[model samples]
Target: MAGLACAGQLAAAGHRPLVLDKGRGIGGRMATRRVEIAGQACGFDHGAQYFTIRDPEFRMALSPLADAIAPWDDGGSEPRFVGRPGMSSLPKAMAEGIDLRQGVEVLALRRDGSAWLLETKGGLVMARHLVMTMPAPQAARLLGRDHPLVPRLDCVRMAPCLTLMAAFPGAAPRPFLHHSSGTDPLAWIAQDSSKPGRHAGLTCWVAQADPDWSAGHLEEAPDSLVRLMLPLLAKTIGAEPEMALHASAHRWRYARVTTPLGTPCLADEDGTLWLGGDWCLGARVEAAWQSGTALAKALTRHLHAG
Candidate 1:
């Protein structure tokens, strides 16, 4: 979503931009998957549950996709929105006219004269300015040697989260329940199929483990971790899930931002390189969008000054 927004603003200002992601598809964390059982398909948004818009600029920027995305439980009051069909649709909508390259991981970034060179698995590309929207640790790894933003990067911290999705053969014991632990491995648990989708008879559950738990078991086997988490989910939901059609574990090494920078954005020494992500502001979709917009404005100013 950040890449798409950045590319959109840059293109609107008459600058061509290329967006690349290491994942198989766009929408870094706003991910969705199709779980098939008995020749029936069910959509599940296993990543982010919902996104909230706190800033006016972000709300205005998202207004175009507002119809495609609707506010969740309008009477609640907090401005939370979900994709009309699913969360992934929001990012797909934003990437409408941009040149996007998926499944391309960036290997390294180096400065050459007045231009920035990005080395990816595919090849190398040169850009007058470089905008990085990855997590602090990942971004630091990409920019090997010391740079202006390296010092500040040390202050950034990320939390890990593990989401477990299970499909049952029959109806769930309970309709829906959101569970959280005060200080346990379990953080949040939700029924996936319960949230605006088909496959009602087949129960789907998502369990997000706390940061400490995820960090400790990051290297453990996927099956082992799932076994440890299944009981907690079963107890919370009041029944044991039967016939696990699909049980998968996702380790989000950079799931949440613990300490965010005070500023909404940051620029490199040469003004040609800028950094932005959820960590710059807060850990939410809105923060990501705001960071991208701020970087775009800063880049526009830098380009005009040149």
Candidate 2:
């Protein structure tokens, strides 16, 4: 969300900003997992379930993507929105005119006089300005402990998440669209098939563990996690685990931000290296967009001034 937002704005400004991502697709945590079961194609939004439109800029920015976005009405106090078809649709749409290269991971980063040199999987690439939108912990590891920016990221704390994606026959009981509990191990569960624009051939559910439970079982194997989480989900939805057509688990090491940096972004004294993400503000898609937009605006202003 942050990377694409930053790159999209920079591209609109007529600056050819390049975005490199290690994942096979865009939308880091706002992801969708697609699968085929019994000749039925289904998808689960295993990452960000839904996003809110609190920021005016974010709401206006989504106007152009109104077709791809939909109101989710999760029965919450406030209105919520989600991307049509899947959560990744929003970022995929935002990346249309931008230069985004997937499956390219940066192994290391260094400053070469006026440019930033990046050692990637393919080869070394240089850039006049660098913007890192990865998780703070990951950015710290990549920049090393000796870097001056590493300490600033120390105040940012992110939590892990363990999610379960399961599917049953279409005849399965339809309990609720969404459920959340503060004490339950299965913190949040949603009837993903109930979302707009989803395939109706199967009943799909997405369950996410709370931060405390996720942290405790972060290192457990995926299959073992399925064994543990599936039963909880089945009990909640009044279904049997044996009736599941497909079941799987996904782990997000840095899923939610517990403590934020209290700033939109971090930058070097020379205005060359900038770091920002959802951790810069809070644990929301709007926050990531804000951080990325702020970084891009600051970087653009610095470049023009130089």
Candidate 3:
């Protein structure tokens, strides 16, 4: 989202930018999955469950998505907007007509003459300017082990998340649409089938382990993790584990920002190399978008001045 938002603003200003993602598709945390079970099309929004828009600019930016973005009445402090069909739909919408490369991971970054050379498994990519929107830790890795930026990024901390996606045949007990229990092994649980535009057949559920639990089982095997979580989910939601048609687990090493940068972006002395993301502001889609948009505007101003 941060990359897409930054690129979108730059493109709107007549500066075309290319986006590269290591994932199979867009929407890093805003992810979704579809599986076939018992001749049913089951879906799970395994990452971000929902997003709220407070910034007017974000609302304006999202207005074009129309029905793809809908108000989810989850009884929050304010209106909660979620991407229809699946959470990934939001990033897919933002990336419309933009130059995007999926399944390509940038292995390293180096300074080459007046441009930044990005080394990937496929080949090398060169750019006059660079904006890295990955997590602070990831950005640090690209900058090398002992770069000056590493010390500055020490304050930024992120937590991991272990997610379980399960599908149950027939009407599984849905005590609530969404529930968060910081004390329980399953810290957050959401009935994915209740979300708007999701495929309705089996009762789909997404459960997330709290940061502590996720960290403990960070390296656990997916099948083993799923085995450990499914029974807890069944006990919580009153579903039979044996009736689960599909069950899987995913681990997010940098799931949420525990400590933020408290700024929109960090840039080199020349303002050509920059870093920004949700961690720059807060842990929300709105924050990521704002950081990206703000960084683009800042880069535009700096370039014009140069």
Question: How does each model score on TM-score?
Answer: 0.92, 0.97, 0.97
Report backbone clashes per prediction.
0, 0, 0
Query: Which one is best on lDDT?
Result: 2
**TM-score of candidate 2 on Cα atoms, chains taken together:** 0.97
Listing every candidate in turn, what is its Cα RMSD in Å to the true structure after a full C-alpha superposition? Answer: 2.1, 1.2, 1.3
Error of 1 at 80 (Å): 2.3
lDDT of each: 0.78, 0.91, 0.87
Off by over 4 Å in 3: 178-182
Q: Is candidate 2 or candidate 3 better by TM-score?
A: 2
**Clash pairs detected, candidate 3:** none
Per-residue alpha-carbon lDDT of model 1 for 1-306, expressed as tens digits?
666778889998999888888988668888877677666676667788779877888788888887568665434468567775677888988988888898988888888998988888779989888888888888877776477687787688888888787776777654464656587577887666655533586877788898888898888888887888877777777766444676777777788898987676788777887888888888888888887888888899888998
Local accuracy of candidate 3 as per-residue lDDT tens digits, 152-180: 67789999999999988876454546465
Measured by TM-score, the strongest candidate is 2
Q: Higher-lDDT candidate among 2 and 3?
A: 2
The TM-score measured for candidate 1 stands at 0.92
Clashing pairs in 1: none
